[model samples]
Target: MASSQRSRSSTLFCAFLTLLNDRLSESLIFPLLPFLLASFSNDGRIIGLLAGSYALAQFGFTPLIGALSDHYGRKPVIAGCVAGSVLGLGLFALTLSIDWASVAWVSGSSLPLGLLFLGRLIDGVSGGTAATASAVLADITPPERRAKAFGLIGVAFGLGFILGPAMGGLLGRINVMLPLLIAVAIAVLNLLLVVGVLPETHPPQARLPLPRKRDLQPFSPLARVLRDPRVRRLCSAFFLFFLGFSGFTAVLVLYFKQAFDWGPGLAGAAFLVVGVVATVVQGGLIGPLVKRLGEWRLSLAGLGFVIAGCLLIAVAAPATAKVLVFSGVALLALGTGLVTPCLRALVSRRLNDAGQGAALGSLQGLQSLAGFIGPPLAGLVYETISWKSPFWLGITLMAGVVLLVAGGLPGQAGPRAEVT
Candidate 1:
């Protein structure tokens, strides 16, 4: 049994590494997105659409992938997704190499732009690996250790953002296509790691039967999830939190560029700051805080911090206050770091092994919905209203999240009682 448990740990570690690589590839594009899109078109709306397109695909497909994972197995789903990512990245690199102006176009964008969108769409569709990974973690971990275990996901994000953006910045200086190619290589490496190191967590006995035609319908899982009051409340709060967070993230690079006249390298450095703060909070502080504060209280406190950070960021543009901006980002990162893992743990605890993948997949689906909506909405606001508008929007949404979480979570138990 001890040896079996050790093997499970090794498998989980491999999953963590795969997640880290995925995040790394994803983050590498964030710092460079504004510049890349600017080369094609100067409109913020177009940029927003490009970003939203990725999330839109993820929002549509992640639940399906998650359900498929539950019906099949973790390893195959993860491997296939990573393989898709590699192809997507390679296609993205190819787009960058093409000269769009040389080709005649009668429509909205050049062929290269269409190819770029296609690549992003492919990547987004396959991005369900994160949800699948979370389900795997849920399968292996008990409720008592879940917050800590889920925090490992945050650790992966932190590490990925820390390294990815910085590397992207440096590589963008050499050539814009270099980062995308590197991301492809990383995806290939991740595929190899999954094939070689990871084992199937979802056994045949544990697998859900293949879905029927109605069950396979696109929105069916979401409808089923919303029907449950507990899940509905949890998912509602999660949606709001993600909406606010996504708005902040979608505009962050643009915010730095507009507010401080920072380039990609400087913008990347700012992301690195966020990653470091998040890493510390999620990797180090979460387990103890969950032990002491309970997921509910911690989630509320996190929302409060996020709200405060948004307010600070909303005002940071007036005076070009670097300290205020960085402080706000740090607070935002810390808050999200605490909230994400705890919320995931809470959601996982609510479900049993059989439904873990679908439940978490639905959770990720909502997050992707937020990602789809938030970036475009924020970009529109930024272009039409003001640079600070998105932050103000974030503040409002996060304030609502605080109320939602406070009222929704159980109030009778203490931290230890609730979690352990």
Candidate 2:
């Protein structure tokens, strides 16, 4: 019994290690943005394109990966994806250094635009990120413990962000290429570790052909999984919530730096504040809160807090408003952390084998859709109006989400509670 328990612990830890590596890739890149922009002499539109491209890849590819995981055993697909990520990051690092060798190696100069797209494409398609992690969680953890398992995943993510930006910022001061190189090394190591330690979650007998357009025609999958009205409500809630959240994230650093005349270090610190608050809320508060308030009510309350936080951002005074800005962003982070787990739990609880990945992938797809559209939209709004415009728009959208979830969720709950 003890050996069995230890084995389980080892597996969970391995899964977390991989997840942490994945998040490190995300968090480390943020602090390098200014360097990337200034060095490239890229305009704001191009910067937003870069930001949106990551999401575009994730959004475009995740569902396909999810379906593939379902059809194939999770192990091979995941391991391959991890290796792909290593290669992608390695190439990214190499590209930066290649500037010393020749301009041809960079993303866009002289080279075909197709090759430039391919770099982001590989990063997006090959990471085997959430899909693999989610499948691993499903394979390893009991249903009752899934929420806790996922919360721990969020904790890993938070810790990654906590360390990633600080490390990246410090390293970025040395050279713009430093963080990318570090990310590449970590990705390589993580790939090796995952292949060495992790077992296959799905077996070869279960493998299926990759999903086609006809198979996942949105309405077909949506109808299959979204039978429970609650699922629909949750999806709607997720859509709006992410739309607002993505818009805010897309703009916050630029807004702060411009409005307050802040440096990268200060902006990174503010990001740290968000990560700390989120870590506390998701890791520390969520499990107990779920026990007391129930997932549904907890989500609604979280939404309200998010709305209020955005409202506060709308009124914040630039430069001098550090206290208000941090406070509001902290609240926003807390609210989002609190809601995300419970809502994900709700979705996981509702789905059966037939629609599991598709459903989750759809939710992820919606979030990605937000990512694809949100940043550019925010950039446009910022250009046309003010940096503050995104926050105000987010506040309004979040308020609508709060209302929709409150009203629509109850009607959907009765049927969904039976899916499990």
Candidate 3:
């Protein structure tokens, strides 16, 4: 019994590390994306598409990977996926190093560009590590203790999320690709850590049968979740919130770089501010705020702040207006921080015990789907429509979320979660 407990503890540590790596890799690359894609093409459309590819791939593959892990067990699935991430990040770094201009049969930047997209796609394909890590936690933890265990996952994620952009922005000064290489190293380290230390928490005898055909589809469960009238409206609010958030953020760095001539350091600082605010709000302030304000009112306030932030950023200029953008970012971070957890909790409260899994699962699927679609669409609008258009679009989207959240909510529903 002691040995079994030690094994669970060891595997749980590894799982936490995997989740940290996921957040680190994501946040690290975010600020550097505009600069990275500048090598292939300076076009906003291309930049947006490249940034969106990772999420797009993640959305399509994580469900399948989770199912595979359920059937095959956790350690092998994690090891393989981390290995794939290592390959993908390495490919991207290698492609960046190549001199496509001098190489024969390269046909200009096309080959390099193709390689870059391939790298992101491959990494996205293996983006199941975080999902699998969550499964590991569930396997080792009891129902009563699972919430505390899951909170640890958030801490790991928060640390990585705040640190990644700061590191990328700061380290990027040495070389633009330095953060990318560091991300590659982290992936490799995670792979080694899993292979050497992580145990298979899902025992074979206890494992369920293979996944059904429909179960493998990432968003397949959303259909059933949305059919419930109780959650349907909240579901729409959730999807639109993410769609607007991810859409604008995908192209935000590019916007600042082009608009105000911001460099990696400045852009990274901007992301850092966002990270700090998001962490502070979601990490420390949210529970108290939710207790006092309740989810419905807090969610509406969050949406309002986001809309105002978008307006500020939309009107920001190059010189004195830099403050406006950062201010806007702080507001966005605060609002999103409040909304992310609060809104999800709002969805959860509507569902009974039997429906919890399906409801939460659909919310995640919508978040991923929004990430997949938002960036490219924002980029296209940013290029063709106007530089200020994407923020306006974000404003519109979030406004819709506000209306949806407030539309049918009753006064009695607001304080129910707080009392619980």
Per-model CA lDDT versus the true structure: 0.79, 0.72, 0.87
RMSD each, Å: 4.1, 4.3, 2.0
What is the per-residue lDDT of model 2 for residues 1-420, given as tens digits with 9 covering 90 to 100? 998787677667767878888888878876566455454533344545566777887766666677778887777777878887877666655554555325445545534333434565688778566558767887878899887788667777888978887777677667767777888888887777778877776667766777677765444554554465647867877877887787777667677666776666666677777778888887678878887777777777888888778777778877447888778888898889877777777777666777676687677677777777777777777777777888888888888877766664453544234222
> Model 1, range 1-420, lDDT digits (tens) per residue?
998978887888887988898799988887888766665765556667778888998877765787789899998999988888888888887777766666667244667678888998998889888878888898888899998788778778878989988888888778766777788888888888889878888889999977676765556766777666556767788888888788767877777776777777777777778888888887678889988778877887888888888888778754666778778888898889888877777777777898776777677677778888888888898899988888888888888877776665543333343455
What's model 3's lDDT at 381? Answer: 96
Which stretches of candidate 2 lie above 4 Å from their native place? Answer: 1-13, 70-72, 97-117, 137-152, 196-201, 205-213, 216-230, 345-358, 408-420
Clashes per candidate, residues 3 or more apart or on different chains: 0, 2, 0
lDDT digits (tens) for residues 19-135 of candidate 3? 999899988988988898776777778877887898888888877898889889999999999999999999999998777777878855477888889999999999999889999
Identify the superior model by TM-score, candidate 1 or candidate 2. Answer: 1
Indicate which candidate wins on lDDT.
3
